[model samples]
Target: MRPLQIGILNVMHDKAATNARFTKVLTHAGRPVALHFYYPKTHYPSGAPAEVAAILAPLDLAAAERMDGFVITGAPIEQLAFADVTYIAEVQALMAALAGRAVPQLYLCWGGMAALDYFYGIEKHLLPHKLFGVYRERRLAPAPLLAGLPDEFYAAHARYAEMDRGQIEADARLHLEATTASGELLLVDRPEANQTFMFAHLEYGREGLLHEYQREVTAHPERQYLRPAHYFTDPQTMSGPQFRWEETQHVFFDRWVDRVWAKREAKEVSA
Candidate 1:
C-alpha cells in the first residue's frame, strides 16, 4: 500500500512541538504516513523563533489538494473576528479548493470554528473567561471517525471563543457528535463534505496544558488565569499532568486515517 499523505497547517507558535505531536498520532495508525507541514503565507509568524520558522513551508493549495488528508491546527487568535484575522482569505481559498474533493479535512479548535462560520454561517461567541482545561465529553451520536472511542472521553480545551451549539444542532448538513454536560460543542461531523471539526485539543502532549498555563502566567502575571482543571495530578503543587488522554487521542486519529483510506478506496473503485 502506498503511504498516506497527510498535510498539516500548523498555526501554533510552538511549531516543532505541534508537528511532533501530530506526527506521533498519525503514524500510530499502523501505516506508512507522509506528513507535510505548512504555515500561512498571508500571515506568517514574524515573531516565531528562527528554528520554528525554519520547518514551515508556505501554504500551497495545489500541494494540499494532492494530499490524502489535510488538517488545520488551532491558533491562539480565537478572540479575533473571523474577518479580522489576517489569514482568513488564504484559509478560505484553501477550503474552497478542497470543497467537494474526496480528501478528508480535520479542523481543530479555532480552525473548526472558522470552518463552521465559513461553510454553514454558524457564528462563534466569546465566553466570559477562557475555557482552559481538560473537559469530559459524552458521545452524542455514532460516527465512523469516532469509532472505538468510549461513550465518555476527555480532551483538552484552551480557547476564549465557542461555537453556537444551537446553530449546529439545527443545521441539517451538520451532525453534532459529542458535547459536555453543559452542552459545549466538542465534535461536529460534516460527512457530506468529508470534514470533521473538533473544538478540543486531543493532540496535546503530556505537558501541553502545563506549558500553556506557565506561559499565560508569565505573559500576564497580574491577571488571574484559570489553571487547567482535571489536568495536573496535584493542583496545589501544579505537578503531573497525568497524561490521561493519549490513548483516546490515538484511537480518534487511527479511525480518521481509516476514514481517509476508505474514502480513497471508494473513489478509486468508482473511477
Candidate 2:
C-alpha cells in the first residue's frame, strides 16, 4: 500500500515545532507524511525566502494529484482586508489554487479566515475585545473531520478579530460547525468540498499554550496579550482543565487521513 501523502504549509517560524508535532502524529497514525514548510519570517538567521517563494510560486497541477491531504498553518497578522498583509496576496493565491480540488484540506486560525474569505467572500471585522484564552466551543453539527468529537469541545484561542454569526448564517457557501456560549461562530465545516476551518487551535497542547504565553510576554509585553485564565490547563504543570473530556491533543491528521483513505478506497472501487 502506498503511504498517505500530507503537505503542510507553515507560515510562521514560531509554529515550526507545532507543525513538527503534527508530522509525528501523522506518522504515529501509520501514514507517511511530508511537510512542506513556508516560513515568511525574515528575522530568523537561518530562514530562507526561497522556500517561502517555492510554496507561493505555483502549485504543480500534477503534484496535487499525488497528495492525499493538505494543511495550511495560520499567521499572526490580522486585518480587515487580507491584501493589506505583505504575504497576503501570495497566501490568498494558494487558497484559490486549492479551490475545487477533491482532496481534503484543513486550515487553522488566520488560515481559517483566509479560506472563509476566499470561499465565502466576507471580510473579518475588527474585534472590540481581543479574544485571548481557552474557551468552550460547542460543535454545531456532525462532520467527517470531527466525526469523533463530542458536541461540546474545548479549544485554545488568541485573536483580536472575529466573524459575525449573522453573516455566517447568511453565507450559503459555509456552514457553522461550532459556536461559543456567547454565540460566536467557532468552527465552520464544509463537508462537501472535503474542507474544514477551525477558528481556534485544537492541535495546541497544554504546553503549546504555555509556550505561547511565554512568547507573548517576552516578545510583545507592551501589548500585554498574555492572560492566564484562557489556557486549557495551568501554566506551571500544564494539565487539569479537562475541558474536552480528554487530556490528549486532538490528532487532526489521524482523522484527516481516515477521511482521505476512505475517499481513496472508494475511488479504487469505482476504478
Candidate 3:
C-alpha cells in the first residue's frame, strides 16, 4: 500500500519543535506516513530562524487537497477575534476549499476553535483565567476516534479561550464526544464532514506544559500565572510532569489515522 499522505499546517513560532512533535504522534499510526509541513505565507513569522523555516513549504491548496489527512496545529492567538487574525482570510479559504472534499482533517486547540467558528456559528469565549493543566475528560459519546480510550482519559490544556458548550449541545450537526468534569469541551466530531476538533494538546511531550509555564513566567514577570494543575509530581517544587496520558494519546492518533484510511478506501470503492 502507498504511504498515507498527511499535511500539517503549523502556525506556531517554534516551527521545528511543532513539526517534530506531530511527526512523532502520527508516525505511530501502525502504517507508514509521508508527512508534509506547511506555513501560511501571509502570516509566517518574520524572524523565524532560517533553519526552522527551511522545513516548511508555503501553504498550497492544491497540495492540501491530495492529502489523506490534514492537521491544523494550534496557535497562541486565541485572545484576538477570528477576523482580527492576520491570516484569517487565507485560512478560511483553505478550510472552505477542503469542506467539499473527503480529506479527514484534525484541528487542535486554537485551530479547533477556529474550525468551530468557521464551520458552525459557535464562537469561543475568553475564560476568567487561563485553563492550564492536564485535565481528565469523560467520553460523552461514541466515536471512531475515541476507540480504545478509557472511560476517563487525561489530556493537557493550556489556553484562555473555550468553545461554547451550550451551542455545541444544541447543534445537531455537531457531536459532543468528550468533556471535562467542569464541562469544558475536549473532543467534538463533525462526522458528516469527517472533521475532528480537539481542544487540548494530546501531542504535547512529557515536559510540554512545564516548559510552557516557565517560558510564560520568564517572558512576563509582571503577569501572574498558575502552574499547570495535575501535571507536576510536586507543583511546589515543579518536578516530574508525569506523562499519564501517553498511552491514550497514542491510541487516539492510531484510531484517527485508521479513520482517515478507511474513508479513503470507502471513497475508492465508490469511485
Candidate 4:
C-alpha cells in the first residue's frame, strides 16, 4: 500500500508542535502517512523568528501540489484583513489552486477563517469573548470527516475572532457540522470535495493548552483570568498535567484517525 503523503502548511506560534501533534495522531492509526511541513515566512515583522521565516518566504504553488492531503493551521497573528499579511498573496494563490481539487484538506482556526473567506468572500469578525480553553462542541450532523465522533466531543480552542452562524447558513455550499454552547459554528465541511474547516483546534492536548496559556499570561497578564483549572477542575485528572494531556490527545486521535482512514478508503474505492 502507498503511504499517504500529507503536506502540512503550518505557520507561526508553536506551529512545529501543532504539526507534531497532528502527525502523532494520524500515524498512530496504523497507516503509513508521510508528513511534509511548510514553515512560515520569516521576515514577517510579527516577531516570528527569522530562521523559521526563511523556510516559508519562498512558499509557492509548487509546494502545495506535492501532497495527497493538506492542513492549513492557525497563525499567532493576523490583521483585520487578509491582504494585510505579508504572505497573503501567496497563500491566496495556494487556496485558489486547491479549489475543486480532489486532494483533501483540514483547516483549523485562522485557516478555517481564511478558507471560508476565500470560498464565500466574507471576512471573520472579532468575538466578544476570546474562546481561550478546551471546550465542547456538539456535532449537529454527521459528515465523512467526523465519522466516528459522538454527538459531543472536546476540542482545544483559543481564539479572539469568529464568524457567526448566519454567515455559514447563508452559504449553501458550506455544511455546518458542530456548534458551541452559545450556538456558534465550530465545524464546517465542503462535502463536494471532502474538506473540513474547523474553527476549534482538535490537534491539541492539555500540554498544548498549557503552553498557550503561558503565552497569553506572558503577553497580557491581565488576560490570565483564563485558567485550565476553570475548564479541567477535576483535580484527579488535571493534577498529573502532562500524562492527562497526553491521554486526552490519544482519545481524540483515535477518533480522528478512524474518520480519516474511512474517508481515504471511500475515496480510493471511488477513484
Candidate 5:
C-alpha cells in the first residue's frame, strides 16, 4: 500500500515543536506516512498569527479524498466561544471543501472541542479548574482503535473545558467510547459523522508537559502551576519526569495508523 497520507491542520503558535512531537510519535509508530501541512490564515489571540510561514504548506483540497486520515491539533483558546475563535470561519470553509469525503479526522485537545462542536453540535463546559495533569482512561469497548492499549493507560492533558457528556450521550450520531473511573468522558466519536475526539495529548513526549509547565510558570508565576500528577520519576527530589507514557503512546499511534491504513485498503478493495 502507498504510504498513509495524513493532513495536519496546525494552529499552534510553536509550530516547530508541535511538528517534531507529532513526527516523533508517528515515526515511532513504524508506519510509512506522507504528511501534508495546511496552515490556515486565521489568527489566535494568544498564539502567533496563522500568517504565512516558510514551513506552512498551502492546503490542497483536491487531495482530501485521497488522504488516509487528517488531524486537527489543539490550540490554546478553549475558553473562547467557537464562533469567536479567529479561524473558525476558515476551518469551517475548509471542512466544507472536504465535504462528502470520508477521511477519518482525529481531533486533539482544543481541536477536539472544536470538532465536537462543529461535527456533532456538542458543547464544552468549563471545569471548576483547568484539568491539567496526566490522566488515565479505561477503554469502554472492543474496537480496532483500542486493540492493543492497556486496560487503563495514562496520557497528558492540558485543557480548561470538557465535552458536555449529556449532549454527547444523547446524540444519536456520537458514541462515548472511553472514560475515566470517575465517569468523566475522555473519548467520543461520531462514526457515521466521520469524526473522533480526544481531549488529551497522546502525542506528548516525556518533556512536553515539563516545557509547558516551565513556559506557563515563567509567564504567569502567580498562577502557581502545580507539577503534573503521576508524572515524575521522583517528586521529592532528583531526576526528571519519569518516562511513563512512551510505550503507551506508541501503541495508541500504531493502532491509529494501522486503522487508517486499513481504511485506505478497504476503499481500494471495494473499488
Candidate 6:
C-alpha cells in the first residue's frame, strides 16, 4: 500500500499520551503512514509553555491540503459552553479550513461535540453525571468506518456532556453508524461533510482509563469521581483494567486509510 499522510491536531492538555495512543493503533494499520502533528493556537493546558512567535509555523489549512486525512483529539473542556471555550473560535476557524479543503476527518470526543455544534447547529448538553465508563455499541448504519467491526462491541466513553439523541435521530445529514445502550451516539458519519464524529475513545490503551481515573482523583480529591464502567476484569475488587477495543480500533483506521486512498485515486482518475 502507498504511504498516506495524516494531519493530527493535538488540542488536548496531555499531548504525549494522546499521540502515543494514536500512533500505536495507526502505525500497525497494514499501511505506511506519515503523521504531521500541529498544536492549536489556543487552549493549551495550564502548565504548558506560552506560545512563541514563529515565522515558519505550519498553518492548519496548509497542513490539511497536504494530507489525505486528519484527526482532532479529544479535550477535557467539555463542560464549558461552546462560546465560553477559550479556543472555540480558533477551533471553528480550523474546522472551516478543513471543510474548505474537503479533507476527511475523524473527530474524537470533545472534538466530535465541537464539530457537531459547528456544522449541524447541534448543541451538547451536560450530563447529570459524568459518562465515565465503557459501554456496548451496535451498528446503526452500514458505513465504511465500521467496515469489519462486529454487530456488537464495547467502547470507552468518558465525557461530561453529550448531544441529545433526538437531535441525532432527527438529523438526516448524517449516516448514524453506531450508538451506545443509552442511545448516546457513539459514531456518526456525515458523508456530505466528509467527517466522522466519534464520542468514545477507541484509541485508549489498556490502562488509559485507570490513569485517567487516578489523575482526576489526585487533582480533585474532594469531588468523588466514579471509576470507569466495564473497564476492569473484576469491578468489585477493582482489578486491573482490560483492553477490549483495540481490534475494532485497528480495523476502523485501516478502513479509513483505504477510503482515503480510494478518494485520492478517484480524483486522480477524474483529473
- Output the number of the lDDT-best candidate: 3
Candidate 6 minimal-lDDT segment of 10 residues: 50-59
Q: Per-prediction TM-score, please?
A: 0.95, 0.80, 0.96, 0.81, 0.89, 0.91
Residues 44-158 of candidate 6 have per-residue lDDT tens digits of 4453354422211233666677688888888888998989987788778888888888788888999999998998888789999888878888887787787777777788888
Higher-TM-score candidate of 2 and 6: 6
What's the CA RMSD of model 3 in angstroms?
1.5
Which should have the higher TM-score, number 3 or number 6? Answer: 3
| Candidate number that wins on TM-score, 1 or 5 | 1
lDDT order of candidates, best first? 3, 1, 6, 5, 4, 2
For all predictions, the C-alpha RMSD in Å is 1.8, 4.1, 1.5, 3.9, 2.8, 2.9
Clashing pairs in 2: 133-230, 134-230, 140-177
Find the 10 residues in a row with the least total lDDT in model 3. 44-53
Off by over 4 Å in 1: 45-53
The lDDT per prediction is 0.86, 0.64, 0.87, 0.66, 0.74, 0.79
The candidate that wins on TM-score is 3
TM-score: model 4 vs. ground truth: 0.81
Error of 1 at 184 (Å): 0.8
Model 3 lDDT, full chain set: 0.87
**In candidate 1, what are the lDDT values of residues 1-271, reduced to their tens digit?**
7888889999886788999999988889788889999888878556545675689788889999998899999998999999899999999888777775657899999989999998889988999988888887888888666677777677788899999988888998899988766678788998778889988888988899888888889989999888998888899999888777777788888988888888888887998
The true-versus-predicted C-alpha distance at residue 269 of model 2, in Å, is 3.5
Tell me which of candidates 2 and 5 scores higher on TM-score.
5
Off by over 4 Å in 4: 40-58, 222-225, 228-230, 234-271
Error of 4 at 253 (Å): 5.9
Model 2 agreement with the true structure over 32-111: per-residue lDDT tens digits = 55555444343233655564454442334345545677777766776446767666665665565566557677887888
